[model samples]
Target: MVLAAACTALGLWQLDRRDQAAATVSTVQANYDREPIAYDPSLFDTYEESREWMPVEMTGTYDSANQRIVRNRPLNGRPGYEVLVPLRLQDGTAVVINRGWLPIGNREAGHPDEVPQAPEGEVTVTARIRPGEPVLNRSAPEGQLASIDLAGYGAQLDYPMHAAAYGLLASESPAPATTPVAPAKPAIDLGPHLSYSMQWFAFGVLLFVGFGYAVRQQYRLDHEDELDAPAPVRTRRRPSSEEEEDAILDARGL
Candidate 1:
């Protein structure tokens, strides 16, 4: 029973993982299907989690003077960083744009002197809305961050930022000659998790069945022992011939 319960718990865990993966796939698909919309800063104030990954377009000027690097973002198994430059929107408020990843080649000697710079001048950016990254324990060097915590970045920039949303650059006009590749959509494949869940459940069933068989075999063995056990020996008491003769002589003498 204990073994079966453990297997069942594992099955449930796998099932939960499967569900989470499916939800992610569905969300990605939905985001891909929706038409690109204008990125209105006004809408960000009421942004919902569901709106994440929504395609958006905006016209803004990159604040090339003040750039940041989202550190430790790897690309294609290569150590890399993401360039984040604030875009000054028409409304005067700024939104951070993740310009994508650039490989950090064996920087044992120090990073490249020539950074991949964003295109200058007014540009139209086609991107997906993304939330600020969660905070972590590590502190970052100035102009470099562990994650894209836009609010934290905004605080450093001494400006009020579009608090609710940031952009992942899908493409831009007059794109930078050395622009990094755009962030790709996550693979939509519902992984082997579902099958794994089923396998776990099967294991649980098999464990229960095997346990029952073992108990049955033990019971059968005990029954067989009883059937093969030796029976109690019968005891009989009979007088010897001499004793019988003595008894008859005594009766005759009396």
Candidate 2:
């Protein structure tokens, strides 16, 4: 019983995980389905995770001189860097834009890989808001970071910055060709949680069935000798004296 209960508890835990994953996938789908809203920096003065992946549009000039790079971003199995450039708004506040990935050149030759420059003038950007990533404890080249840490970058820039990073989707720039390739949309795969739940439930059922079968077999074994033993023999008994006297009188014809 204890083993069965444990298996059942595990199955319930998996089921809960499955439900949570489904809900997350549903939320992601809904976020993409809705039309984009105009981005207002003040609306995100206090960061909210729910706002992540919300499509937004804004027009700003790129601060090319204060650009930063996020090291080691991989796309299509090729390692690269994500260019993080601050887009200066008219109000003097800045927001980090993840331009996209850039391939690494051969390191042995000390090859100076050139980073493509952002456009010269104000450009209207259509992008999805992404939550700022946590800072990892790793070293990189100067003007490069380990992840998207908005507060960290704000400190580095010595200026106010939006709390979230905007992932570039499309831009209307004078030099269309200068735009960096946009990152792919976030994945909405439901993952293996559902299958894991089913497996756990199967294990719980098997435990109960196996335990019952083992108990029945043990009981049958304990009574095996008694079941196979032979039956006891019986003997005939003599009649009473009154019955014998009656029988003799009848035989004498008196």
Candidate 3:
């Protein structure tokens, strides 16, 4: 009875989790697929609001001269570096674009400065919305640019200024030379988790039933031993032969 109740409860709990996950995925998909918006800093009230999959369009020119290569970025599961160039918007707002990965070019060859600098002209940039990195114990290296402290950087930019900067960008300019064309978000299914939850519940139920069966079997074995035990033997020592013969003679006549 207890095992059945536990399994039923667990199965119900997984169902609830499945519902919640589906709801969350639906909300996110809806937001991402909603109307496209031009990059307006004021549209975002907080970092969390901006850290989502929304289409962002901006009219900006890349400042290629100030480009920096962020080391250790992986794309398509391959190790490479991302080209980081600043985007100078029409309203004079500066946003960093994380252009896609490129091979670490040879320093001796002119390829050392391999990625091209953005030409000084107006260009359009479209990318997914994201937030600035949070403050943490680790710090970026120095000399190439100022140390990377997200909070401090945001403070320097002034809260009301530019919105959040994302960690990755598909460069949309330089005539397909440097721009990365963004791909649609991949579809993810959560069905396996629900199934796993059911499996765990079943295992938990079996635990209870198996334990009860084992205990009952042990009790039966102990009871049977007590009921079928052999009668205790009354073992006695034998008398000496000479003593036995003398007792026989006295009984006969003497």
Q: How badly does each model clash, as a count of residue pairs?
A: 0, 0, 3
- Per residue, candidate 1 scores C-alpha lDDT tens digits across 1-254 of 78778888998998899888888787788886588898777655555766778888889899988898777887778777788899888888888888887777565332433467888899998888877777777976666888887667888776667767788888889877887766677787888988888888899899878888999999989899787889999998898999899999999995
Error of 3 at 83 (Å): 3.3
Error of 3 at 190 (Å): 2.5
Candidate 1: stretches off by over 4 Å: 107-114, 217-254
> Model 3: which ten-residue window has the lowest total lDDT?
142-151
Model 3 misplaced regions, further than 4 Å = 1-24, 31-35, 48-51, 103-113, 142-176, 180-184, 226-254
Answer with 1 or 2, whichever has the higher lDDT. Answer: 1
Clashing residue pairs in candidate 2 are none
Model 3 error, position 87 (Å): 2.1
lDDT of 3 at 211: 89
Task: Give the Cα lDDT of each candidate.
Answer: 0.80, 0.74, 0.59
Scanning candidate 1 in windows of ten residues, the lowest lDDT window is 105-114
lDDT of 3 by residue, 1-254 (tens): 66677777878888888887786576567656666567876433245553465666777777666566555445567554556566676676666665655654566331224665454677777666655554555444431222223345434443223445543453365455544323446465556658967786888778887989999988888798776889899998887999889889889976
Runs in model 2 deviating more than 4 A are 108-114, 175-180, 220-224, 227-254
The lDDT of model 1 is 0.80
State TM-scores per candidate: 0.80, 0.78, 0.62
Candidates 2 and 3 compared by lDDT, better number: 2
lDDT of 2 by residue, 149-238 (tens): 787888887778886555555454554555455667667877786678678778878987888899989988999998789988898789
